[model samples]
Target: MPPKFGTSGLRGLVTELTDALVARHVRAFLAACPHGGALHVGRDLRASSPRIAAAVAAAARGVGVEVVDCGAVPTPALALASTGAGAAAVMVTGSHIPDDRNGLKFYTPSGEITKADEAAILAALDAEAAPAPAEGALREDAGCGARYVARYVEAFGTDALDGLRIGVYQHSSVARDMLVDLVERLGGTAVPIERAAGFVPVDTEAVAPETRAALPGWAAEHRLDAVISTDGDADRPMVADAAGRIVPGDVLGPLTARLLRAAIVATPVSSNTLVERMQPGFELRRTRIGSPYVIAAMAEALDADPAAAVVGYEANGGFLLGFEAPAPAGALAPLMTRDAVLPILAPLAAARAAGIGLEELAAALPARFTAADRLQEVPTDRSAALIAALTDDPEARAAFFDTGAAEAGLDLTDGLRLAFENGEVVHLRPSGNAPECRCYVEAASAERAEALLAAHLQRLRDRLG
Candidate 1:
């Protein structure tokens, strides 16, 4: 099957992401652009990434555009370097997907390409093939990574994390080393843990049970102030407190916004409702589930009030700053893309300022909790039909949920989100990049959320079976 744009970028199986196909997409992305400059390319540590990055770089060079290879760097780092240099970028990574799959994320000089831009690129791909010149040249740029690191170090001085002892779960994340170095440079004692020798897809949103079980033991062994990690490309963050309890991104995003003193916060509809309660002082904007939607909403908020301290985040904990906001260290420049480090650092700083531990800081947030899981290999058409059946027929919904109570409300912004009279929430959306059906549940307690998610996902599994 042909690759298609998902919530963030183009994704497909590794076998499908051939050199020719990647070259075609790269050419199409460039063809839709108004100007041509050196294209900055980066990749994750996925086994296929090196070859794919080479193919993309060769493709850019073939189109008469120079190629700057920012070897094996995080997606956000490449985006930052590209934005600063006024050049477009391409990241070869599958993100949290399995090793057999891979994807490409394209960025313009300003930031990530919008949904509209994806349409244009797809259109260009269908029109015609561009003639390739004898291959151009590819230049290796080792400084891009250093430049990205400097952004954080300069903003938050060397002692920003002076009193903290953080554990870095180095599970094959592209930013593993960078995270360790950054924490140490900020004066935190960075203890490396779970350093995997092979690629492991760690989903920040729906962490594996085995990994979750190991966290507390790891933290205890290291006597950590907090445990931090990221998805494969390091665009999404996963953090745990000293006790080893994971802090979901939705919660972290709002807390980070509060730390930055944001006047406006934008998040996806799928995020926890607690964000609304915790930060009642800020204007909260909820969009369909995706960074592009969040980014667009943030842009609108900033346009309305240029001086507004605006930021955006997703349920997966990827944070975006639309404009600079005041911090204890300095003003953070607008990255306008999902970043892992800022969210991880901002909360630590907040806890330090409050003279409390990360656990206490999390406990102080509203008491609502969220849990998510997915039924793998679920066909998209089947998932759509299941949702339509429940959405359209009250009896069907009652039967599926095994509850006689009527629905309190329904939200179809990006998926089917149902609010029961009992205050339970269930949101179901098909995976954007994989053959799966994702289920999200929120309730008054973590146990209840997990129970509901388990029940709903099992029901989905039964239906699919």
Candidate 2:
């Protein structure tokens, strides 16, 4: 498939993202966004990232835009540094997708581009462009990674995680070393485990069964208080408790917000419903799935009340701070982009502060449990047809669910979400970044949620077959 805009960025198979194609997109981005000064470029640990990032830099320089290479850094680190310098950025990362695929994430000086910006980029790709008279200079910026770590240390204090044994699952994540550095700086024993030399596409949202099985063994062997890791670019976090039980992102979002004492929180409709029940003191807004939608909703909340402490998170565990919030050491400046660091650190700090284990801290949340998985290699058109059929026919929906209970509520915000009278919830949507059909289910117990997800996914697989 050709490189095209997805939920977060422009993505396609690695073979499809040729140098010529990458250069064209970068030039189009420069034309549409119109950044006057230097542009920042960063890449993940993927083998193809360096070559693609070089292509991006060459293309930007061709258009007379100074390029600053922030090599081999997390997505948020590059975003923070470029935004601070008042320059736009482009990250060469496929995030949590497979190694055979890759992508480009664009950021304006202000922050991430909106859906309108996406359309503008597409339009600019074909429009005529003016030639530049001079070539631009390219330089390197190596301190962005350290500065990103400093942001958290200064806010939460070096002793925020004092006396904790945290396991860092360094599974080829770009932020693996940074995570270790951050944890150690914050007064924790950073036990580096499972450090893979090759790239690993560890999707935090729909974790694989092998990874799910491995976490517990590692945690037990290391006697870790918790295990933490991130996706390829380190934007989405994966956190497991002492018992190796994974805490979903929806659970982490509300807990982190409560820790920050946020006045307003925005999340996608597909997130865990427990957020509303857990954080009744704060105003909550639900948007469609994707960081762009969550960021837009957060911006709207801040517009309504500038002084309000606004934050956004997705089911993938990427937390976005929309406002400055007070911390022990100082205040955390807003970085209105999806971040994994804050969510990971906040819960760990909070658990230690309360003199409780990570397991105990998570158990205090509402009993609702959520489980998500996907049918991989499924065609997008097939998934869309399935959703459209279920949406148009009530009987089809009922038959698909195979539950006798009536739906108490129905939401078509981003996908087909139905709340059954039995207090169970199920949602279905096609993966925005890959060829997969995802299903999310929530129930009073974890077993029930997993069972429902498995049954529904089997049904989908059988239908697609």
Candidate 3:
């Protein structure tokens, strides 16, 4: 009964996002769908995801909905099964969250839920949703995984990566072997770090600080192009340069967007640095944040212009749906989830075609760098109040003009954003995808950017408090 609809989907701590809660979500979702003959359920490698998926499966089957358990597969695979099977799907994934967190996202045949449907689902959840008696038995589906790998092979053929040495950091990541297989099939030399069978908490951005220090040396020793890895779900990507510094998602996204000529449908929380450097007519549309927002926008765009939109990705470096044009191998349909493998392979292909390296191309993108951080005083309940108060404040209004610049505009589509003269800007918004109240800042330099962000964050935090 909290907000069932965030930018992406309903997500919360495992404490509240329990099996009972997900049961309610599943019941409401099935009730909303028109032709729910079969429901596809998949989960990530998260410790809690399997449990949640079981609950969701039981809940759906309890309502007479046939269930196809796709097992531990990427979200894209689950989504593809739903769309391919012409069935409703629910993914039990916490995607990139710290342990102790989990979430469930629903798809109604089209790979995503509409805002209208989202509101309805929340309303339904607020009311009691008793589990109905089992209408159908749950069955395991093994075909989804093979179909998933086939989709990737079709999109990115093995011709491009004939011989390149790559090392996939094999922490407890699900995609560790998937990536290795993809690389091998693509004819790349893949070296995987030995992985344990247990769960590994990997934060795309919260990469181990030691990895930072070791990255460059490792790249030099191994002579690698990039350190490609994913969070637990394999939905979001985290890349390290040959020197081993984690490339921020904001930076990685546009690179992939530009490479694929991706007419991006992204959220405004992402930095506009890519906008400044992109080629003329590099199409982009900003949604709020999360895959659902971007996915909904892409659906609309595809409806309008089908072939022109090659791919859709996000600033979080989640390469959403993409089209794998006809290859020598076969026809490839893009997956509808935020995929880690695509971003890795796509940009590397770009660098290869351009006769450059990932690091060098990264250097040329743009000067602007944006960072996402939460103001300590601003919590979930207070974020909305802050954005509303700041946007309507008389003093804040006057202060805006004081920074005075001609030919600049305001962008609050997702957050309280004010674009300034020198590309120095501030964004105060709630993390629609997560709990924290986020404030973003981009400036001419790192020091100035941090300072400006800190000052602005302090003022908002004080005000919110």
Candidate 4:
């Protein structure tokens, strides 16, 4: 199978991402950009990342570009350094995917590659490849990582998290050490746990059941105030309260926005509806379910009002700031790419300032809850056909939903989102990178949301089977 760009970046099974294939994609990317400066290369802690990074570096050298080895850094760190230096970068990571899967994310000098950029890269794929260099001179750069760490330390100050005892779930996330360092520097007791030798794909949005169950036990063991973690690439955060309940990203996004005093906030349509009701004073913009869409919306918001603090976040808790905002400690610089640390630390700082626990801050929001699950191995074409039939015909929709009532409304922005008469929402879309169908549900309570998602997904599974 050929590696392709997903909602995030290029991803595929480890077996499919052969060195030759990665080199081809890297060559195409370099050709599309036509940059002469050093191409910064970074990787995560995935078992295959080092090999993949070597392939990308070789490809860059083959195209007569220098390679700056930012070695085993977080994706956002690579983006920050590359954009600042006006150089392109390629990060070897599979993000939240399993260990058997890995991929690449390319960033231009400005930021993440736009949809237009993806098209250009894809167009260049068939072009004649440049001659491979027998040996490529690779320069190692250790400053990028430190600079990334300093960004938070300076913005939030060293005492922002004082008196907090935060547990760091040091899974195979590349940012594990950085998070621990940050917490300790900020006067918090950083308790590190669950340091895994192998890669662990920690998806913040739809956390694994076992992970959810262990959080409470871990919290009790360490007497922790909260637990913090990130996805494989450390671009998305997973934060759990003292009771071991993970706060959904949508809820955390709004809370972070409120803490930043953002004037305009952008998020995906699949985010919790509570965001709309909770942050009444700020302008809320909803886009399609992808970072690119959310980033574009945030850019528009910032362009309209340059002084307005515009921020965007995904349902996975990756926060993006379009402009510098007032932090509790100081002013934060704009980081257009998705970042895990800011969301994790900012909410904690806000809760501390408010003299409340993270759980209490989350509870202050409206009682809307969202749950998501995916039907694996469902073909994309079949998922598309099913969605189209359900959207085009009310009878089909009613049949699928098992309700005789007519559809309340239909939203086809990114997928088939049906709003029923009973104030429940169900969204169905094909996974961008994998052969799966994802379903998201929002209801009045946590139990209802989970029940809705379970019932809907079970129905989908039955139909697919």
Candidate 5:
């Protein structure tokens, strides 16, 4: 398929994202959105990014929009800089997808473009507009990277992570070096490991089996208190505890929210249900999957209670701040976009201050575990058909689950989520960016959650593949 807007951004294969197509999208975005004279552009380390970024700059410049090239930086950092300047921004990255694929994330001065904004851009794609009187000037933003690093250090305190040995699994994330800098600047000893020479598609939501198996060994070899990394674009976080066990994003989301003392939290339905049990006092809003939906919910929460401290996070571990809240060292400004650094640093800092290990801090929460995996190369049509069958027909659901127990309830918020009488849950949804069907399961224990996910995914493969 040609590059089209998915749950997060415009995504498709690299071959389909030609210069002409990329330029058209950029022009369409500029025409549809209101912004200042300047637009900021940033990219990831993928081989295809530089070319796409150049196309984006050219297209904006052609329209009289001054281009501020932010170079290779995290997606959130680009958003922070552009929004700070009261300008729109574009990030050239495929996020967690494979390198053969690339995409563009658009942001207005406010934050990530909402679903309404996506429709506006599509409607403006074919509309004619006069060219600028002259080409706009191009400039480099050399300070955005440092400014991003300073944001966390200043708010969370320079010694927030004192006496902690943190391992940074650099891989090929564009924020690899930046992550190390943040850790060291916060008084933690950062041991960089497994730095890759080229791009690595690290999906925080569904980490590769090999990487999961290697985390423990890395921890043992280095005596690490924890290991942290991010996806290609550095918006989603991946964290492993002291024993080298990877922590689920849902777990991290609630923990970080609690640490931030969030009064109102907005999270996708795919996140762990334990949030309600752990933080009953906080007003919670359950939204459909995707950052756009969560951000919208945060906005609604703020509207209902203007004094509330609003926060948003996804099961993928990307945290969004909806208000300027108090941190241990200072006040943090609102950044209503998916961010990896805050979630990663906040939890680590809390654990350090509490005089406990990351694992201990997690153990204090309600024990609800979640596991997710995907069946790749499964077409969206097939996935929709299967879920429709199960959703509409009781016989189909009974035959598929084979649990011999009635469902406690069913939620069609974003996908087909079935809650069983035994308190187990199975949720299936088609991947928004690629040809894949994602499955998520939850249970009282990690082993049960994992087994449920494995069995259901195998069933999907048998039926769809």
Candidate 6:
């Protein structure tokens, strides 16, 4: 597979996610998402979303799949509704990536399109014909607004956030409405961020320096207990603390697990710097990087034990938890999939359940800093050559010399990994979506870790140059 799909969905630039490709993948994925249930469609505010989502809806209707077109909603709402209704769904969102890019997210009746399902969709693409468009009856459900908001209020109850304020930095997240509504439902004031006209891409890969710098002031001015936000599709979060400091996802992940007091399924690249920080009672299981990897592991674990309490999958700041009834063991577990809503609702509710500030809840976890840098735009022609060389060529590994890897004299774990003596690590992989190469490094101090990242980026650019 040359990868027409990426970590979450079938993604490509606006130009590359052509109508032909859009129609084919959507048709194949719907076939694989099972049949005879309703099909819902939703999308973000991306420029290319309408075209792609329309393509998906057309394909679904062609297959006689009943369509519920919930236009311009966050990815989570679409997922929640589909899963709740026992129907499959498709969402058009490029997530936190730049606006120049867009993609389609296919949902099974349960949650996101899984890896096995993706492979099935790809395989079906070869055998299927181009779907003829359908002129199905269209029903618009504006009630997604009220229903999605109610899930939060019901989860935490209105009393939890009695006097807190939340700063919603809505650069381009589809969850902007939900976050503000969640604040009001929780009895907190929702202060929207300052205006920025036009399509200002709000990807975590490119979070503005001003946003990071302004967090403290935003919190103080608003008397906010925290600032909450999601990526464009509303699948992940970018959160800040009461003191007005941006909280990295890696830091929040383990804290979320500890707070939930549930079993954790995390990616291996996660901050092992947290192993000692957790409460001795919690169980931690590490899997590969993708959400499917974590989700699959959770399914398997839960299969063996019906009273399972898998908290969340946190590779970065946006961790997800599962909360359901029957209380795993006299205590409630969270939702099934990784939800952007969990970071806001679960954490807030967990803190309220404990009667403490989020800061104090965070403080229970051992403190350590982690940083990541992406070495981007490594031409497509060079990605395989780089992946091949980094893995098989000792001569190529020599090129990263003086980067923390070469300086520390380390070797592989997953991709070209370099683990430092100082509880830090640098991991390298060619981009799963783009031509760019990626280097994810985290260390004890932001300055030192970021400095090391800068050096490594320069080293690779120089070597690959």
Please write out the lDDT profile of model 1 over residues 81-184, one tens digit for every residue.
Answer: 88888999999999998898899999988899998888889889865656656565678889887788888888878888888999999999999999999998
Q: If scored against the real structure, what TM-score would every candidate get?
A: 0.97, 0.98, 0.86, 0.96, 0.98, 0.88
Lowest lDDT 10-mer window, candidate 4? Answer: 398-407
TM-score, cand. 1 vs. native: 0.97
Clashes of each: 0, 0, 4, 0, 0, 7
lDDT scores in order: 0.88, 0.91, 0.70, 0.87, 0.91, 0.68
lDDT of 6 by residue, 1-465 (tens): 232687677767788777777877877877665743577899988878888888888777776668889888877777777777787888888776667888788888877767989899988896665444655556777876567767666656676676777788877677787788788877777889864454555645335667778888888888888888877877777777788766666666665566556664554554445655555745666665667767777777677786676655555455555545322113433455556765666666567667787777766666565665555557655755766676776666666534433335354434566665555677776656655677667666667766766787777787676
lDDT of 5 at 168: 98
Q: In terms of TM-score, how similar is model 6 to the real structure?
A: 0.88
lDDT order of candidates, top first: 5, 2, 1, 4, 3, 6
Candidate 4's C-alpha lDDT?
Answer: 0.87
Q: Per-residue CA lDDT of candidate 2, range 288-364, in tens?
A: 99999998998898788888799999999999998888776789999999999999999999999999998899889
Question: lDDT by residue for model 4 over 1-465, one digit each (tens)?
Answer: 356788988989899998889988998998897444679999999989999999899888887788999999999999999988888999999898788889989888878888888899999988997665554568999988889988888888888889999999999999999989989998899999899999997878778889998999999999989999999998899999998888888888989898888888899888888877874667889899888888889878778887878999988899998888888778888888999999999889988888999999899998998888788777788888888888888777777884233468888888899887777899999888777788988888888888888889988988775
Off by over 4 Å in 4: 34-36, 129-137, 402-406
TM-score of candidate 5 versus the correct structure, residues matched by position:
0.98
At residue 122, candidate 2 shows an lDDT of: 91
Q: What does candidate 5's lDDT look like per residue over 282-356, in tens digits?
A: 778999999999999998888888777999999899999988878889989999999999889888999999999
List runs of model 2 lying over 4 Å from the truth.
none
Quote the lDDT for 142 in model 5. 92
